[model samples]
Target: MSDKYAVPNKLPAKQVNVMTHRKRRLREEESHHRVKRLNRSFKLRSKKRDYKKPEFFITQYLKAERDSKRMRRVIMKNNFLKGVDDEEPKLLVVMHHRAHRVASKECTLIMNSMGLNRLHNTVLLKNTTESLALLKMIEPYVVYGYPTIQTVRDLIFKHGFLRIKGKRTAINSNKLIEEHLGEHGCICIEDIVHDLFTVSDNFKNVRSLLLPFSLKAPRDGWSKKIGVSYSRGGEYGNRKHEINALIERCL
Candidate 1:
């Protein structure tokens, strides 16, 4: 048994680089084992410390505290910087169709690239020149506009999710947010909300981390069909702030 467990003799040191590669592989194997041990210890300690509580309670508490601090900061900032630094505009684009006769394949590809592949799929976009150009290309198949703070919050709380390891996971606890986005200064749900509502510098990263919101069809359905301008009482094009009313019904 002892002989079976012994480390194998090193290969004949042919090519100094091969020896270096072998050493690197061994180091990686050791590090992997170390990490496994640490995780095991952590789980054991957790079980010993609080058998009754769920494993994620600490993550939830930390997340709640972080969110509270962020909210307080927002309140204080709003009070002091009411008009000093107005937030940049953001666009809430909703897809009502996949392909349209008026839309080219390139336009549909742009929409799909933006994660709006299904009917009633919604995404928040920064109002930059590039985004505006893309929206122009797909304007005939979607509705978009400036969303109010309440609308942003409601959407996150009700339909918001984080994409982790390419899986759509619910925002049920702060631990999830921290695990996925803590490095980006978003440790809680409120951090993402603030970043999006204010269109902060981290908005792009936060938006990409979030899964597209799958909204229900607008409560009475579209009054006007797609492939026309919203000004003409059509469903496509900008609804401005009026988009809020449409999103509310879907919510």
Candidate 2:
């Protein structure tokens, strides 16, 4: 056969290189799978050890029940004392300070129900026994206290927003207020502040029109970690009347 037309007895250098590359890739893939298999085996062994027994969950449930009862007692006692003195708070300002990552499903539900789904969001709630009970259950995730009249006024004037038709709108004019809340007798911003501060019958209607107040971090920063209770020098839990001071800094 003519040399030009004859097939080569040995493969070209390029073909040899391509074959070697394919073999190298196969080896690498094999090694990767081996490593993954080893890792998966180790993980399985660790998971076996980490698995919690049913008894462990039972103990956890019992502990939670005990804590719930204890908290209920404390709330009832405080409410009783306040009632005796006619000093029970009419309204409470609750601020959500922590993130949902650390909150349980129950706490998240309560916070959402109270319009406190975001960090640093504040809402005004009537200080009913049921409300207090729910707050105590999620005490670790919120800061609450009785807001003064001035604080109520400032919050409504400064941070107050309305969720009109699912849109967040500022309280810029009395007309907007009258449009949404005139029937409830809250015809203006001042009416909202007055109703909220006095916990009047129109309070719930006014609150329904307003969105949760989104506040800034305090100018001086939190006194301690956000997870700590206010009584323990942290920002969470009830701050009593001190919430007004916190609100001022945030505003």
Candidate 3:
């Protein structure tokens, strides 16, 4: 009865070999499945990483903005060159009417670059393509127009200040003018007014000497709504020759 319940001492060699081969095959299959699972997990992790990247539409918008700006610059250059070849450049009186609190950082930087730091501050700029382009960019915040000689002269004599040694100094004497702009042939206030009015070759040098003119609000207050175009019955944007009248009122 004991012998009937007992197992054989050893199995046949072929049987043992077959069992060993089967175990090895099972182990290999398990290892292959494990490797496949790990690969699938890695792929899923990569997919998640890609999803965490910046949105496609946001990148597209940024790319479009960049392209538009580049195209705008090219257009501005062409227009400026054409104007230069056709006729004399005009002087544009650009006035900043808006406050900085509501302005974008880019607009503020453009204003700062043009020396329009304060409200109602006006700068005399050449009607070059670059200037016109910048004006177009900040049109909603500022007003600009062609100024008559009389208007330019009055603005310089009445409200013009000089940026000297990093300080705002009043234009008092030709001697002071000579001290700063002598090399540029602008020895007197008249020279500056002439250069500015005519938009001459020395215009840039003369403009560099003068600070933006600070003017009062129009005497009767703004005739039209603020922040609207002149054509739309507002005081902002290009008022053309009508800017002289506005400057007169402010003065």
Candidate 4:
């Protein structure tokens, strides 16, 4: 017989057999395919992903949050502030951004000296329909933040977004608001500040101030008489300690 087609002549003497060898080879190949299919299924169920996030937007948000916390720390000093607790601010110095922090600090200082801290009034006004509800709830002083370029934009956006349709709440207007104060009563702003802060030399006779440190100039018509102006925040930069002196003079 030809060698290619010939059966093994020595098979009878062999320890290993062709049938056993063929079965082992088929088992290995079947196991390999089974393992491959299992791997494919596992990959399909895996939670790992190659997705990435938008870098710039995330960085901007993080930066803004960090800045906000830092500003809050300076504005809401533990020695003076206790957060917006069960009580609201009495002299609500409304502000929008970085200047917001300075205005808040000034007002806080003003309120502390004027003794309005005892009255448990005042709070920052947010532009929201819920803000109106909260206003009714808190009866805040509506001190305006300076309508600076950005603040003006923010105001327009906020007002457009949060304004209510019904009659907007009117700020307080009357003689009760205009108290006699400041250097023999010659300066009207001091008395108003005092009323807003609720301070007295006698340590008594006072109520909460409404939005006293606000960016708003003095109330309408009386602003010129009182010499009120929109104070640039820059004026307070190095002379911050002088704010205490200015407030004291008013007191």
Which residue pairs in model 4 clash with each other?
Answer: 89-121, 89-122, 89-123, 90-121, 90-122, 114-199, 141-211, 196-209
User: Which candidate leads the pack in lDDT?
Assistant: 2
Look at candidate 1 and tell me the lDDT of residue 97.
46
Pitting candidate 1 against candidate 2, the one with the higher lDDT is 2
lDDT scores of the candidates, listed in order: 0.74, 0.82, 0.81, 0.34
Instruction: State candidate 4's TM-score.
Output: 0.22
Number of clashing pairs, model 2?
A: 0
Off by over 4 Å in 2: 1-85
Q: Write the per-residue lDDT of candidate 4 for residues 1-251, one digit (tens) a residue.
A: 77899777665634457777888999999999999999999998795766757985576566556545644565454322323333432222232212222223334454344323433122233223343332222112222221222322222223211112333322233332233222333133334334324323411222222222222221232221111222443221212123232222222
Candidate 3 wrongly placed segments (more than 4 Å): 1-89
Worst lDDT run of 10 residues, candidate 1, spans: 77-86
Q: CA shift at 111, candidate 1, in angstroms?
A: 0.8
Q: What's model 1's TM-score?
A: 0.61
Give one digit per residue, the lDDT tens place, for model 2 in 1-251: 78999998999999999999999999999999999999999988777574788997786677556556756776677753333124767889998877644325555677789988888899999887778778887787788999999998888889889989999999999999999898888787888888898889998788887899999888998768886777777778888888899889999
Best by TM-score: 2
